[model samples]
Target: MRADAARNVDAVLRTGARLLAEDPAAGMGAIAAEAGVDRRTVYRRFPSREALLAAVFQAKLDSAQRVLDEARLVEAPVAVALHRYVEGIVPVSRDWPVDVRRMMRADPAASVRREEQSGRLDRFVQRAADEGLLRADVPVAWARATLDHLVDTAAHGFPLIDPPQAADLVVDILLNGVGRR
Candidate 1:
């Protein structure tokens, strides 16, 4: 693809993520307008609203994969890896607000990617338990679920703060309870 076209596609996907996040029923024309791209350009690239949404989810997944790689989950200490992952993911969740779960039926490939990502997270959570960062008595699935919720809260509940800052708060909360110490 040409440089200009790639830029246009990026713009459209970003705008689509934002608008669709605000309102799932957002139209293609509205996304094109917000993206500052011609409607025909978006149409030519996506062909349909579902196609565009699938692409946005794919973009989010791609960003997530990069974050996972950068986090070095297998090599880094569990605490450090957790912070890195949350910091990287918070912005991704903010930028590409469309939930991949919503796109699963529309895009099987995206569903597969999501499952792979989830598997990695689950393994990381298990590693945390093995490393004594998390309690071995607790179910690994529960810890993983809690971590997922905490990240979502950090990303959406406190959108005003920078992701790295939010990541600190998230990691702290994950490691320590809110009750009095």
Candidate 2:
């Protein structure tokens, strides 16, 4: 594709993602109009709404994966890595908000990428457990599940908080729980 064509495609995908996040039923005409592209252009690039949505979902996943990679979760101390990862991902999750279940079913490549990220996260949790950051009684799987839950909740619920503060809150809650103690 030419430079201008690529830019148009990017604009359409970005607009489609934002629109679909706000309304899953958003049409290609709306995406094209929002993207300042002709409806024919959108149709040429994406034959159907499902195709456009799949592209948007894949783009979102690719972006989130890039953020995770930049976080260097495997290189940092588990505590630090957890905070960095959460901070990096919060905005991606907030902006995309794709229907994860539908994405997994509709896009195999996305599902594979998600599994790869899950495996990386599992390794991080295992390292934390090994370093005694997590309770001895807690199984690694349980810890991994808990961490995933905490991050997802923070991503979905704490959009108003500053990214760094949201990361801090999530880590604090995960490590200390909510009880006054």
Best by TM-score: 1
What's model 1's overall lDDT?
A: 0.91
Residue 100 Cα positional deviation in candidate 1, in Å, after optimal superposition: 2.3
Candidate 2 stretches with Cα past 4 Å from truth are 1-7
lDDT tens digits, residues 89-170, model 1? Answer: 9999998988767877778999999999989999998888887887667898988888889888888898899988988988
lDDT of each: 0.91, 0.83
lDDT of 2 at 61: 85
Clashing pairs in model 2, backbone N/Cα/C closer than 3 A:
none
Residue 141 lDDT in model 2? 97
Model 1: residues with Cα > 4 Å off, grouped in runs: none
Give the per-residue lDDT of model 2 (tens digit) for 66-120. Answer: 8888778878877788888888888887777776777888889888888887788
